[model samples]
Target: MNSRRDLLKTVGAGMLLKLIPVGAFAADLVKFVDVRLWPADEYTRVTLEHAGAIKYKHFLIENPWRMVIDLLDMRLDTTLKDLTSRLQADDPFVQQIRVAQYDANTVRLVFDLKTEVKPEIFTIEPIAEYKNRFVVDFYPKYPNDPLLALLQKEDPMLREDEISRALRLAEAETNGTLKLESGSAGSAPNTEVAKTEPNAPVNSKPKFEVRRMITVAIDPGHGGEDPGAIGKGGTYEKNVVLAISKRLKTEIDKMPGMRAMLTRNGDFFVPLNTRVKKARSVNADLFVSVHADAFIRPTAGGSSVYVLSERGATSTAAKWIANKENASDLIGGVNIKGTDAQLAKVLLDLSTTAQINDSLKLGDAVLGNLGKVNRLHKPRVEQAGFAVLRAPDIPSILIETAFISNPAEEKQLTNAAHQQKLAEAIAKGIANYFAKNPPVARTPLT
Candidate 1:
């Protein structure tokens, strides 16, 4: 009787299990909407932007130095497949990307690396036009020294004695300390060889005599993923500003005893803080950030120059403009998690009274010159708390070449000839400022 009861109980349990569906046990799926890759000299970044939240894990593989990323509860989708088309042959780190279904409910990604890399992985919550972003950055274990980069290029600052001699010569020209014949621009002094453009004039009258080369850092605002303000005619702010900045660089390059370095020479995203650090690294005598502005009202248009305000912005519009410019890092997708908070804080708090004073003079000179070529938004130099201009020791100014949102101004900005004119105006302004206010002799950086 006991054996019969036990066998009946086992039969009933088996019958009940067969009634359940197999699909009920499957995991929930996560869809991938987009993937982007940004390969820069600083590091290589791979971003997976998806519709829904994702659960993922990554690990390093040896011998070949591959990075494996596994997404849980996800299947291979077309969006993920498109990642292959985005790979560039010139990528500094990643050789290629491979995707496969690692198991029943997980999709895996393998990154073939060109060399050993220190990888940083983090996730950013959805912001602006972006969805949830899973970011992977391959940074070299040993980052390159910024000073080394400066040294690799031509040094842009003068020694103490050089500055003193230049000052004495300048004072002599103005204070009647000495009377030297004013030579046409492009004409070299007896001491040095001059490289002049075929159509350009040489340094006709160099009132300031610097013993060492004077370096200026020209920064073109917004690039790479950051398109900046878009014009109605389809001109991108990044491209326009870059063109203008490059023209300005060429003009500055031709000046005797003065050299110029660009913050970026290509279409790539550079962090705002990095831009500041770059100016400092090269020991720039002056920093000029070139940009094209946009406004909510299409009728609102004109060029403006801004210097850092120690307290508050000069006007409400100035504050709004500053806030908008500061948003580039967010739109361009900075790896905020990897940023140095302390360093960033220091940069933000670094604006000194002397820096602002010098910046105002520079802004006035540029603003005055800009009016000659383009309509001035404000008659006087505007003051705002612009992050790119916060290099405490460097005299910096931000110039808005024109309002790209305005139909008329957009046309002006897009014209190559107009761009050259703007560049020349700015170069002239810089030359004027340096002529009167010679840079003080700074100790060489260790």
Candidate 2:
């Protein structure tokens, strides 16, 4: 009798489970909310956003060059398949993408590559409005040199000469035949070389002044997954700041003996330290980060310039702005495990007093010129601990073009004519600073 009772209980539990709706089980499966692909010359990033945690494994395959990623315990869905449609014909890295259900609970993604690539795949926890994200970045096996790219863009005709000179200087320095000396803490380093002739004098003064192209690193803040501050009219801070930065670059490039290099020339996110590294790599004369400000209060309107402050932010507003800007990396999704610890330490520890002073001078010049185009947020430049401005050697400043939160300023920021005017004012300010300070000889990158 007991054996019969046990059998009846087992049958009853089985029946109960069968009666449950299939839709109830399906709802528990992870659902991909959205997918985004950002392609640029530097790298390509793929983001998969889902409502719940996901386990993934990715590997690289050769002989045709493909990347395979397996999503464990996730069902294949239409949103996951949409990744193939996002690939652009002119994408620098990827040629095609294929998605399939490899098993009952695993969705596989295969990325066909145009060339050899180094891939970094990771996951990010939910933040702000973003859900759990699985991110993949494809970088070239051999990355292009930022300095070479800058020179080529400035003048292709002069690229060969510049490269040859840089190579020769590098060789001489390595052989202990050349030494570079700076007149002061903030001045450019002067190149001093030993005589080329055998048994010649050990020290020889430069015969003439060496004037190289002046490089200014123009950074357009907030991009890709990070939309920055959104205005009431739906203007994205990333888009407007990019337009303004590009215009500023055009204006700067037109100046005599001056050239500009944009940290990013497209819609992509760059880590803050990467921006500083690019400026230092190019031996930039000045680092200008362009941004559109936002405030909780719509009444806040006007332009402001900011330099790095060691003590603390000059005001509460400055501190708030810095905190917001600094959060960009978190929103943009940096692979924390892949970050270079040494590089980060250098960026954080190397802010010098001299750099700050020079930054202040540049800020003052830019602030004065900005007042001509729009109302000044403050009569003087504000100071804060901006991560992008922590290049130990280069003078850096952040410019808040206008408060994008304000309706009037948002409309003006979207206007092309106004953008051009802002560009002109900024260019004039840079010109003024250069005229008064006179950049010294450039130091060659090692």
Candidate 3:
């Protein structure tokens, strides 16, 4: 015979099991509703919907394109064909559409494109007068013939190989399997000014061949149990950034002399300290931390870049932003005291005043290249005490791709084509920076 206590316990266990949605245990809980490229003469709109409560919105806009996605707290139960058919045959802006499940809780909608375009994404929460919204907007750019050839020949396999090597390094270091250095071996260099000469059938000396490959660590922000930010459209910052990071990796792989590694590839949560550890372990030359900004104002519609903060935040606005970004661990339920205190102290002490200076220079170079491809929030790079940017040696920058809080920008961020453009711009910025500032090679033991 069962006692009252036993029955109660059994009932409670059943209730708990019921509470855990089937989607949670399954690898991917989210489903795709519809992903379509709705084009207007002025801009193109790419929309997404899924199951779940409203968490957040995201916008990714570099130059010549934009992407926005609304994250819902609900699950999806739609088919890919159902959504793809919505794209009209007459639409000229979007080149193609691709949709697939990213994970148990997320779906990816990719938009292929014919050309680059400037873009923005944002989310609007219900206010006294307005309803909730996730929006994306676009700003067209003039054609660049050189860009076409570059995109056509892009490769994803080579990029993944580099990323795999870096990940192994990161994992080894995180698990105490590897010890690394923070010295400045190969600092970015300056470029010689170009001069034009008359072409009089002079047999030009064959262009000097230089082979340089850079190892970069690309962190997709939040992941696993830690949803970085909750958007008005129920989008999780972790899932969204991861998708973008993977796309960025694909493009980076396509390049000839560059490779990228992700900090955390799946839904597992990673501590702030661990992020930098991974970058340093792999001897990453540059660290680009990708994120979608969220704010009280839904109207904020531009991307911002940040290097490490030397003296904390200089202003109230900076402080606020820092606080929000730092809160990511809280959502992910991190045991900071248990894992990071010692490493934090060591990294800070080892992170000499000079490393910060190098980081700033790297930020400037990347930002300058970014400006060439996208609309920037400010002409100068912003500084904030971002934990993700704490690597003592790596030249690191955190990019707020765009605001997920603004409705117009949010729509653009979900568009696959725009995401590709954003990826291209970032890649281009990195390439340009490296071209001018080639890395010094380490001598091998004879």
Give each model's whole-structure lDDT. 0.81, 0.86, 0.61
State the lDDT of candidate 2 residue by residue for 1-446, as single tens digits.
Answer: 69768866777876757755665566566589999999999999999999998798989999999999999988888998998999999999999999999998799999999999999998999999999999999999999988777756655666576566765664554455666553454444444433333343334334322346788999999999888999999999999999999999999999989999999889998988889888987778899999997999999999999999988899999999999999999999999998777887876776479889988999999999999999988999999989899987788999999999999999999999999988898899999999889886544323
The top-ranked prediction according to lDDT is 2
Give the number of the best model, judged by TM-score: 2
If both were scored by lDDT, which would come out higher, candidate 1 or candidate 2?
Answer: 2
What are the RMSDs of all candidates, in order?
10.0, 5.6, 16.6
For model 1, the superposed segments whose C-alpha errors exceed 4 Å read 1-30, 155-211, 443-446
List model 3 lDDT by residue over 1-446, tens digit each: 66768866777876867756764664164344333344654455543433222454545544634343434343434554465676666554665655555565454555555557665454333322223333343436652222122222333333544444444444444455444433243522221201122332233331321223477789998764356665688776677677778888887877887777777776655667878877765567888998887877787767777878878675565567777777666544344334668778877666446556766676777677666655776677788788788777677888777777777666667767767777777777777777776765422111
**RMSD versus native structure for model 1:** 10.0
Per-candidate TM equals 0.78, 0.88, 0.52
Q: Tell me how many residue pairs clash in candidate 3.
A: 64
Top-down TM-score ranking? 2, 1, 3
Order the candidates by lDDT, highest first.
2, 1, 3
Q: Give the Å error, residue 405, model 1.
A: 1.1
Candidate 3: residue 281 Cα off by (Å)? 1.6
Q: List the residue pairs that clash in candidate 2.
A: none
